[model samples]
Target: MNKSSGPDKNRMDVKKLVSIGIAFTLFFIAQGNILTVTDGGYSPSPKLCSTLKLVPILSLLCVVILVFVLIKMLKHKYVHFKNRELDSKTGSNGLSSMQKDNERKRPAGAKNKTIGMGTDVIKLFQQMKDDISEENTLTLGYRHLLDLACEHLDFSAGVIFIIDHNGCISLRGYSGIIPNSQENYTLELKGIVSELFERNMPRFIRDINSIPGNCQELFYGFKAAWLLPLMPQGFPVGLLIFFHKDVPKHREEYYPKLDFVNIAACWFYENHRNNRIVACENRKIEMLIKTSLAISSSLSLDDVCRILVSDIGKSFGCSYSYLLLSRGRQKEMYVQQCYSERKTPVFEPEEKIIDIENMTWLKEIIAFETPVLLGSEEIKGYPQKDKDILKISGSAGVLIAPLKHNKRLVGILVLVEQRSAERARMGKEVLDLCTALIAQASAAIENARLYSSLSDKVAQLTTMVNVGKALNSDLTLLSFFERVLDGISRNFKIQNCAILLRDFEKDELYVVSVIGHYQEDALNKRFKIGKEGITGRAAALKKTINVDDVSKDDMFIPSTGNTGSEMAIPVILNGEVVGVLDVESEDKYAFSKREEILLSSLMNQVAVAMEKIKLKQLDKERANKLSLTNTLVKKLSGTLDQSDLLANAV
Candidate 1:
């Protein structure tokens, strides 16, 4: 029943054995030694021999020989079956039928070489499919694969370069003796190399010197090489190069034999690549969640700026991150926050003030309120200042995201990619990935700004109420003016403040009271209305005026050299200019529209209070005169002397 037993031999052997069994049965019958069947039961023959002497000696000898012959034949058949079964089970050590036929004809040691090569290939694939642990990174796995490949193909050395999804080619692994002169590691798909990848086949270089100069260095110590493009799904993901010190005798034979190895390498690399992509995506999701939490945790502008720069720089793996904000209606931007991944940062936080006029690219982004990507080509068209800033970071690409809400540009976020071919290729992809994050950040930043502005408005209203109380309080003219100046300085945090009243009869403006660092000449300083200082101009025009930079204003008459900015508001009474309220600061553009409104309202109350105090002084003066006149008339009437009365009148 063994599968390996030959059918013809088994049939012939079975017939011979059957014929022998019949002969033996006939002999037993003739001697009456066999049992006979009866109606009721089997009975032994009455004439059965009791001793061997009764039988013929020749027959006994024949019987013995037949038994021995049967035993020998059976043993021989058993041996044949076992040998055939072994042959079928092991498949003659994986040799094909043709190989087995010609194997005997082949010369000595050829079979052994073939067998060894097969064993090595099997071992290589087994090791390639082995589980990768945490300690065995993808790069290490590639190196191990390269080593196994070199051993299997009988190559001296090998290296692997992988082309990632970003279209960047990078060296992943190397094995065996790398030459000392091979310092350049950068590899690219160029000319024949590119064509090799496109063909998706293995190439053999008979002479290393025959290849391009850029690739010849890779085979410095080698005479020839095998270039295999590891393609998993009909597209090359990696390139494997095997170096040989001597040119292969059968160069064409070697390339065809790489089919199995190429398949295994491609599968291994593609699987690892997919895993890495999934892990990266998961990381991005985690970063997005964390950044969202950080952004929502604060309503302060400063805090938001800090979180934005820090989180974005870390999340995107950028060289630098910057937050720039537009102040008021100016066409300028100031760096609110900066984060750098480099050990030595190039720019400090709030250290840069950018003029939008000079940077047309930034100006376009602000105007359009859209994100922009600046690659080398785009950067070339930009201004020198912009180029210099980018150069400082060693960046080859830039992403500028506008932070806006309701069509208003509140600020912009800048992300810089360092000078790496891989990073430069990733710019567009990174921009796409960060689009959602930028949108979320924009909304959050806008909300934070609004909250901050609301808080400022509330504080301004509180200051206005307190200042109005001081202005309306019952006090003498000098005391009233002093209290007004004191309230203005304390509530508004102004370093300098003064009330300059117009002397209409003299067509001049004179300082009534001053607060904080005013020069002695400024205490009672007078100006010709309509032709003099900022305060006088405001009084003449009966309007509010703000000089962001006092030094730049032609009509600015400095109370102190330290004042960088000034604001003047005219206090009006009964449609007439009563006085001007002037505020100064050492910082330019220190005042906003809210501050102007608050001060203007307080000035109105000051005008009303001044009028009330002036009325009270006039009534007291008239009463004193009336009382003195009455006392004089009473003395004259009682004395009845015309001369005394005339003298009193005089």
Candidate 2:
């Protein structure tokens, strides 16, 4: 080949041509021993053979060159072999045991068949990471994932085991028929099972019955189990185990598909562990919100308890929840209002409940001043005759939390589990959440009760002063009625109100005082007892009347705006009905039992005031009658001095 033979070619070409030409020449040159040189005769002058070197020098030089060439060739072979191996292994599953010609030679990290993770799984993992770092509401991130596993793996139940405060990792959810399954399926941190938890990787047991060591406890009922470690930020929080349906033989071909499930389950478990932390933190923030709202929005103990318990359940995913109060060191807790999904309270005690100090369950929770989680076994041992009587009631699990306010335990919060393990599993996270919620709820309950007691005292004093003021507010019929109406209306906004006076001789009810929008009609109408309208019915029957829905009332008149509720009162003077006072509301059922009592008292006052005015009228009429009688007597005597008599009479 024609090549550029300048300075670059000169060094390399000279070395290559000399070595190759001499190597072949040495192969052809074979000679026998000749004459002596420097000893006694003619000498050949000690020069190298063919200007290369002396025989001894040449042999040594050729050996050195050959070693160099061999080392270089070996190095080249090693580099190529290593590159091929690396190429095969970069992203592929296992080392290819196939033919050399069939060996893959793609670049390192190139797409390979064993690559299962794509953009979807990567994005999902990224989202899981974000959820770990931030706040989240749902702690069970793999709830939906478990559903997928159920569909794909053909298994019924699965569970995630986490270390508790006591360093015990217990089984939560399970599937299949197993003997004493509830009792035996548990993970202890210090023992054999927990050693695997520390390892934090995928551990598969193909046949549990044939394991090397004493795995009879864990694998007793289980035939095949796959336990995958859930690494939250690369640290093991727990292990997830899935038991196969019936039994299965571990096949190599099944490993690939099983590997996919393991990868997915691992990611979900990681997300769930992170979410548990995030969920707890979010609940803490929610507790702050509920605490602030419970204090500021209202001091209603009932309303505060409602808000507190709801916030707690939302944060903690507690099973059964309630707020309890002891009320001044009574030792026994009074269950105020339990938060649950019930239309009405399932249990309503007619009398206050008393707590037994000697109760085994209450000993540590109440006296020791520590929260407790009574496991399924403890709950089963609890002797509950009352529950037996209920027939369908059982204490699923008990989370006994003390309620503290102003550094004092005023109450006990009992969270009772309602749903089964299929729906939710109660864990240590739930208990911690309840403790925090109780702390916030107790503060609110204490404050609200104090506020209510104070408010009751102030209201009692105010009513005494206002009733006397009502008696002297006005004198005339309409003016006095307006003052009375104003007092009642101060607390309630009514659409229309009227005063009706019974004209007994004519047997008619006269509309005297009216307020609100339908002033024209209320002023226009007059009725006798037993008339068609609601007001007349009250007068006819002589009873206080309350109508919840005016729409249902057959004689309800459509007034200005919409009328929804109505009320009427009978005014009794001298133990006989003299008039009626009627009130109407646009609000449906605006008047409650308390309002009904107060309004009746106002009507009684109106009767007394009106009766006082009637007596004064009677006294004036009697005096006029006596004056006319005197004039009649003067005329009847028939006296001759009529002018003098008329002057006397005047």
Best by TM-score: 1
lDDT of 2 by residue, 1-650 (tens): 22322233345655895888687665544221222245576543333345444577868877887676666556545644654564353322222221111123222222221233333433443343334334232234444444445555555545556554555555533334342533434454554355554654445566655432332565555566666555544555556666664655433223333344444445445445667788668867777787877876657676777776665655555554666676555566555666554544544442225455546556556665657876555666666753342211455555777766666777776666655433444667777766666665676787887776565445433443454554454355667677666655554445577788888997778787777766456666777677666777887787888887787788665544667788878898777788888888876656544456666776787788777655655766898889878876867587768786767666
Output the number of the lDDT-best candidate: 1
Residues 1-650, model 1: lDDT tens digits: 21212344446656787798699878877766775567887676655545345569757866876676677568656655654564454332232222233234333443334323544554455555563322234567778777777776688898877775446565667888653442435456676678776665567776666544354565678887887776665666677888888877855445323644564565566566676567567756876786677566656777877887887677667878788787775477777778888856655322465666666666777675666776544565666676675343335678888877677777888887765543343344456566666667777787777777786666566656654565456567878788778776776678899888888899888987888998988867899888999988898889999888787899999887698889999999999997898899988777766688778877887788788788878877899889879989898769988888878766
- The whole-model C-alpha lDDT of candidate 1 against the native structure comes to 0.69
Clashes of each: 0, 4
- Per-candidate RMSD, Å: 13.8, 14.6
Question: If scored against the real structure, what TM-score would every candidate get?
Answer: 0.57, 0.47
| RMSD value for candidate 2 | 14.6
Error of 2 at 46 (Å): 26
